[model samples]
Target: MHGPPDARSLNRRAAIKVGVALAGGIPRLGALSTDAPLQEPARLKARPGDPTLKAFAGRQQINTDGAQALAWVPESVKRDVASPLVLFLHGALRRPEIYLEQHISMADETGTIVLAPFSTIGTWDAIRGAFGRDIGVIDASLRWVFERWRIDPRRIVISGFSDGGSYGLSVGVANGDFFTRIVAWSPGFMIPVKTIGKPPVLISHGTEDQILPIDRTSRQIVPALRAAGYTVDYREFKGPHAIQKPILEEMIRELAGRR
Candidate 1:
């Protein structure tokens, strides 16, 4: 009987399977422009023996609406002289604090400034026409952090988990020029791309996820992205909808290297 598969072995098998599926078929990776510069901001440069990792920690709330306040990770701690900023969007449940807590360790390891803006209302989608305002608030908040911290715009990375992951993809695809990298963990929303951007994407989904079917994302979404000619790094864990520690570690490493 076969023992449990190692992480590297599983990843290799997945990559080969994905590669073979695209071979002898209409080229889907042709839509992206690989000539774009990969240089990130100087702030993202890895520092040796930097104690800023332990010194960075703070929170603040922005009044997006008159009465409603949007909680976010403000630029309070001045650790690194220059550091890349990362905007994290929460899931549909709209709990920014929870999301931040979950990913805080990753941020420390990568030395990235994380900003998670909470929705005033429970959900980001207020109504049919309200998405614009909701997204605008998020954009404004990001700009606020950028201007306040003087962060490198090119090094900005956006990511989310589950419902947040879906929103992150939507936001990144819609405004791909603003971010250098996009990561979606168990993303639910998958949209078609008309004009592909240069930002590389890392999509992680669980094969055993019942909330969001793996086939839909791995088969349909991945194919659509490939057809659009986008460089997508897809990984599927043999678990459920939760974000595991090992996966988070890999994500941090990937984002750090991108910068």
Candidate 2:
């Protein structure tokens, strides 16, 4: 049900087509409009009778009012402690559960909470163009998480892979003050509506990324990010267009310590 090679998949072929189409040029962004109201983020509450607080980690389909999201929360820390939260956006056609499992170690190793939400469609809304419903879902999810956990607002990070990576770059940069850090893996591009405070960014790409070739992605993204004056930490791997184990480990390591 996650990502394999479906017809609706945004595979390497899809990446190529999209990248080429966007080659024309990206539009400049200003601040987001104040209209188009979105449903307020839902709050999570623990039942008074509960002996232990809910410590759950799985696929949680949330119907926050009319909004829908797939979030994966790490098991609650013992003694009712707080943990850092990472909002991970999955690559095109990928599922949130798989992304959580891939980085499951963060739960115990760093006492970090992970939340991954699905896009309205197969790929993120910004991938095809500008921001859309997905952004609303993201906002709602963060509000939901904040209601339950004692998250350090200063340590929240927006990160993702591929298409999700690109969207993360766009949104994270636009709302830099909101997200202290932005981690992007093999991102295609960074297009934001408006600029915000400078948030340090971490990026990694494989040398042999045939899909969104390195030259066309991180190579461009890193410098542009730097040109924009963002503190950037970039890494080049000897793998493909995927987030290898070591890359994931490093991401978690830095995130866990960012707070």
Total clashing pairs for each candidate: 5, 2
**Top-TM-score structure, candidate number:** 2
> What tens digits encode model 1's per-residue C-alpha lDDT throughout 1-259?
1111221123445445434543443232233233434431101222122332222245556554332323333344354455666677765546677666666666666666677876556445521112444565575565545444545556777787765676576557656766788888776554322333657888887787655556754545566666666688888778866566676677666665554
* TM-score for each of the candidates: 0.68, 0.80
lDDT assessment of candidate 2: 0.67
lDDT of 2 at 9: 53
lDDT of each: 0.56, 0.67
Considering every candidate listed, which one attains the maximal lDDT?
2
Please write out the lDDT profile of model 2 over residues 151-204, one tens digit for every residue.
666667888887878888878866765777889977777654466678899898
Please give the lDDT score for candidate 1. 0.56
